[model samples]
Target: MDEALERDCVIAGGGPAGMVLGLILARAGLRVTVLEKHEDFLRDFRGDTVHPSTLTLLGELGLRERFLALPVTALSTLDGVIEGQRITLVDFGALPSPDDFLVMVPQWDFLNFLAREARRLPTFELRMGTEATGLLHEDEDRQPLEEKAWDVDAAVRGLRATSPSGVLEIRATLTVAADGRDSGLRRAAGLIPEESGVPIDVLWFSLPKPPDPTPPTLGHLSSAGMVLTIDRGDSCQSGLIIKKGEFTQMRRAGLDAFHARLTQAAPVLGPVVGTLTEWRQVKLLTVQMNRLPHWYRPGFIAIGDAAHAMSPMFGVGVNFAIQDAVALANAIVPDLRRGAAPVRTLARVQSRRERPVKVMQRIQGRGHRVIARSTTGRRVLPRPMVALIRLASPALRRVAAHVIGQGLFPEHVHTGSVTPRGGHGEVGGVPETWSKTRLWHNEGN
Candidate 1:
């Protein structure tokens, strides 16, 4: 067996949740290692919408200016077209200044930015091309029943992962499962998320922008279906919603039928729809909503999509995952600083995050139902309901803006940086150039 490495915390997955958690904990003076299976975060069609709440977080971290320096598209209002009439759904302009608008940047750029800032901290290490294989555990501590009360017979000590240095064993005071919805570590810990049914899937593709400037409307709905468009300078990233399990039928219907559907929902894209002539340009996103009844077990816990998968509704998945990391760090940094395991405090992370996740998932589910029903009637709202909504549009827009922009129970960065730049650091590891290999250890952590 390889020599074991020790750290204060080891995070599986290097996505938004894992990276944010690693940065926060490392800033608080704990040695943190984050593992990413991908060599880099360059994948496309990923979530790129940055809500106002996350923008506010950047300011707290002293990274707002640095992040904004990158090329980004800012959106201040969310509008929707129903049956031929345009209606404003959300007006973020009513919120406080500076961060009232939504920022759109490529997901890869955002992840890479977080990683660079994290590596500046002396206690942080990011391992690219490393994948976590399973969890590590030890028998419960031998103490009086009252002194050593834990829910499980075994406590998760850390995890086993494949790194460039062959089989690596990481022993940490806390093990985090942030590897996303199909988390191997979460499954290794024997935790399963209860599925919340989602009835629609999204086909994401890009079309050329219309020659003339268009309204800042984001969503278009008709009896035919729903299409969401985000202006990306020269191109528009469009998502066409279809009932779940219907991709096969869509393929069989031919590309022309798909083009007709896109135009039917959002006529503004009619000129550029022909650019998506090939199926290869389109990507399918299977939406899911689910959460674990319990998020922690003994010395380990799950966060982000590993604990609860969010639907594509409102584009809040990335922001919510980030909030989860902030909450976890705030809840346990004190315990870690004292060299304690934080087993008892792990529950607090779950308790603080579970309600918001559940509430958002519920709201997304209702949205899915509305879309599913609207597809059959060609219009999302009836004439009478439209009149009522138009009359109350001002009040409704403010409420909608607050919900989408701020989210529920937003968290602030509570942990402070412990080490200055260059003061004692092993920032980034040597880049690894190793092939995939499997190695297992029968010994427990």
Candidate 2:
């Protein structure tokens, strides 16, 4: 068995959030170790769209060109189907930046890129096939006790992980729970999210590219409910926005029934469903948005999905996770450099990131209510009501821009700058690029 590994910071979970944090901290010369439970990044049907806001962050990190070079599709516009007709609700061209639209790239490729970049940094190390079981607390000696200070112990397994080589105790000045929604560290810390009362779940599926497609881009079909569709380059993917815990019963009804309902929900999806050959080809996933009351607990803190898991309504889940990473890194890097109090630094991070997350959760809640309304409510709504919503398309576009364009994290993430003195130095400036003009006017003034 190898001896205990010590670092300045230990990040649990190698998803986008943890990997990005590792990259930023390692570049800042902090001894950082990222523990990932997964042996490899080979998951299918995961989030694939990188929003303009995330693209902006990539630019600041000097990785924009590399990210764009991956096999991806750039969506130039946002389209929605209302009453069975396609309408261009938001034009990406109206957004002031050169990279206006979303870049569709696989989550694995994104994580692999981050992991590779992290590996290149001397101060960073990534341990895959490892699981963080519990947190180790510092004893009263003011020194991390051999076992106590090494509070976060992870089980490190080799490539062919059968029997664990040994317990890998990571002694660090601070620990980050980027381990995702079902976080062991969050549970260990006894922190739970204050539910936002948004109870929408999604079932995501991918199939062979539709034979014939119309109005391809980010789209939604609204009838009794909202069915979202996105072009996955070679394949056309769709998500059915339903109430929480609805997918299991649908799956149990068998693939034929599932496909029939999907085709029926959006007749335009018939082409996409025709290509499905086997039940194994379809993937189902559930999404919810939750935020913790407090993001920090003494020596440990939570970020990304661990801190706030938003609904997939806007397809901003990964973007938000990456933004959280940036915010967490920005908040803590200087403190780590100066050896500030772990508790104080974590508190500052939470305060900085909390409001933006709350705003996002509220927006997601509103979207859920819109999609999940009753059939009578949707059909009986007057023409004036329909016209009002259509008139508000620009505002909706702006909201989309803020959510997807700037990412769920605060503005400092893209600006590579922080607020000036006495003005909430921990907080980020509002996203200026996603301006109201671009949102309401549909033109870059």
Candidate 3:
């Protein structure tokens, strides 16, 4: 094995949660290393919605000006066609600004922006094309302890990983699993999410953004199928929701039948549905709404999807994941004095985030049932739901926007920048490479 590397914290998975936490901690002058299996952040069909809560956090970091300058579409409202009747689901105009509208930026741009900011700090190090194979603990079956600091008993000490070079070890005072729904770190730590019995999955594909300007975001619900269109400037990111384990049936019916069902739901797309010539462009996302009963064990804690796998409800996941990072930073900022945080310290993270996650999951679960039934027959809203929505009206619009945009308990940045441990002043001075290679510093064997 390669000689082990050491840091104050080692984060497995470089999703929003991991990246944000790494940035905050590094800014606090704590050594943090984030390992990502993927060499770059460019991935299709991933969550891209930057909710108001995340925007507010970015603003608190004093990075919002540069972030907002990026190519993004701000959505003031979420309008959907339910059986040809247009309904304004959530209205951002009712809320306050900067935090009012939902910003739809490409997920890669958002990640890269955060990564660049973290790179400005000397304590931050990100290793791409690196995969964590297993967890390391200070228990009976521990690896050869080359470092004296990790000799004590703890549920987790670090991680065993492999990269382009070879197998190596990363020893951290605190280990974080910010990996996604199919989290390798969570599995290595023996943590699994409890399913909330969701009944739908999504087939994601892209269509050309209409030449005629349409709503920045659109949701169309029909009896046969449901599809959402996200305006990404040049192209529209489309998602078709179907019943769980039903992709096979969809495929067996052929792309023609699938296209017909989807088009029937939203006739505006009739012109472009023909452009989806092949099935290769489509991808499937297995929907899940779940949370871990125990989010931490001694030296380790899981955050974001690693702790709670949310459905693609309102695409609020990116927001929640970022919120997790902010809350974690708030709870553990004081513990930076110690080489590793106390095991009991993780409970603060779980406790602060659990209620908000459960509340969101409950709403998603109900939405799944409603959508599933609608997909089975002629598109029709239940009478009670219609009556309830009509009665609620504008109030419901505001409530939905608040819940989806800001979440139950939004997080803010409280920790300030600290001096680097090595006495480095105002961490800067990295190479100025701009291409994909710029994302990683390849360490040779």
Candidate 4:
């Protein structure tokens, strides 16, 4: 190895889970190093919905004020235009005071903000452009006392990563895999997820912003398919949900048919349909719903999409990943103070998260089944059902809002912090302008 380093904790994939975990751990005075393969968080089409649960977390961590300062759009309702009739699926406005809306910002902006805040902690180190290729192992002879007592044969030591300089071996007391669904470190640790088999995939692309200042509807559902749209100021971030493996058939039918499908789902986009002239402009998101039967093995643990890949049904993927981070941090911080967390301690993290993850997955699965039936002309929502929904809209909206926004067993930031930055602030107002979000570190001191 060209370079070798030791730390109390080392995390792979600086997405929401990894970044948040690193931040909380370092804030509590543990040395943490986060390895991110990408040089920057500028990628497009990532999950951008920062739900109420996460917004409340920002407040608990004293980051709400700073986060709200960013140019972000807040939506008080999750609505869908079904069969040309608008329906409010989830009413965020019915939630408790302050965090009664969902904030929508680019995923890159959120990640960048977390990274900047984490870097301010002296015990934290974020290495961009560093890719963790495999897990590091310790021989039985060199096993630590805790490993021997816990009966762990080959406890993971850290990771083998490749950076611009050269090969590097990181020796950490704990290693975390937060690299999303296709987590290489989790694979290297010989962990596998139980695939629940998702029935739909999403095609993400952009359309020119509409002239009307009113933000685009959250979702549009039709027999053709479902299209979710978000107004991103200059352009609209849109996704067309299709049956799994249907993209190939759509491509074979040619762009004209695809354009027809788009218009069928959301007529409001008909005017901008011509803007998407090439196939390259669209990105396919292969949706997967799965969770590792086990989230940890000795010193290594998988969190976020690495542990449980959530469906994008209600745009809850990002929030769940972040919740995993908070829950994991809360579970392991005390253990880290004593030394490396034991297998039992690691199991606590999974134990606390497993039920919530499974429940959400079940909910998403039911949603997919409905979408499947609807796309196949199965009359999933009869006229009577529509009337019933409208009748129960008030009560159903409150229930849906609580479930989707707060999530089941939402986590709080209990890991304590060294820096007394901004405390949890009220999440009431929207900025008049949203085009001024810059990296947190770039603002004037």
Assess every candidate by TM-score: 0.90, 0.82, 0.90, 0.90
Give the per-residue lDDT of model 3 (tens digit) for 1-445: 6758877789998989999999888776677899999999999889989888787888777678778899998888888776655678888777777678888888999899988878776678888999887778765355433332332244677888889889879878788999888887787666767888878899899988655645654788767568899888788899988878999988888989987987787677777887787888899999888899988877888999989999998897888888999898877866854565776678988998888989888888888888887667755576576666666768878988888888898888877664333455433222221222102222321
lDDT of 4 by residue, 218-318 (tens): 87776767888887767899998888898888899989999998887777888888898999998999989999999999899999999999988888999
Which of candidates 1 and 2 is the stronger one according to lDDT?
Answer: 1
**Number of clashing pairs, model 3?**
0
Q: Quote the lDDT for 435 in model 1.
A: 34
Candidate 4: where is the Cα deviation over 4 Å?
140-152, 212-215, 420-445
**lDDT, candidates in the order shown:** 0.82, 0.68, 0.79, 0.82
- Collision count for each candidate, in order: 1, 2, 0, 2
Q: Which consecutive 10 residues in model 1 have the weakest lDDT in total?
A: 436-445
Worst 10 residues of 2 by lDDT: 436-445
- Candidate numbers, best lDDT first, in rank order: 4, 1, 3, 2
lDDT by residue (tens digit), candidate 2, 1-445: 2546667788889998898888777656667778888889888777777888777777766668877888888887778776555566666665667768777787899899877655655567888887887666654332222333223332111111111556567767778889888887777676778766755566667766556777674655455556678787887777777667766776678878766777766777776676666666656566667889888776678898899987776677787778778877877766665554367777777777777778777877886776776222354235576677688877777666655576554444432222222233212222322211100110111
For residues 1-445, write the lDDT of model 1, one tens digit per residue.
4657888889999999999999878776687889999999998888888999998888877678888888888889888886667888889898898889898888899999999888777678898999998767675342322333334767777778887778777888899999999998887777889998888888999888876647866878768689999877667888998889889998999999999988888888888898887999999999888899888887789999999999988899999999999999888877776656666698888888888888888889988988886556556667888778777899999998899899898998866654435444322221211232111112211
RMSD of every prediction: 7.6, 9.9, 5.9, 6.7
Q: Ranking under TM-score, best-scoring first?
A: 4, 1, 3, 2
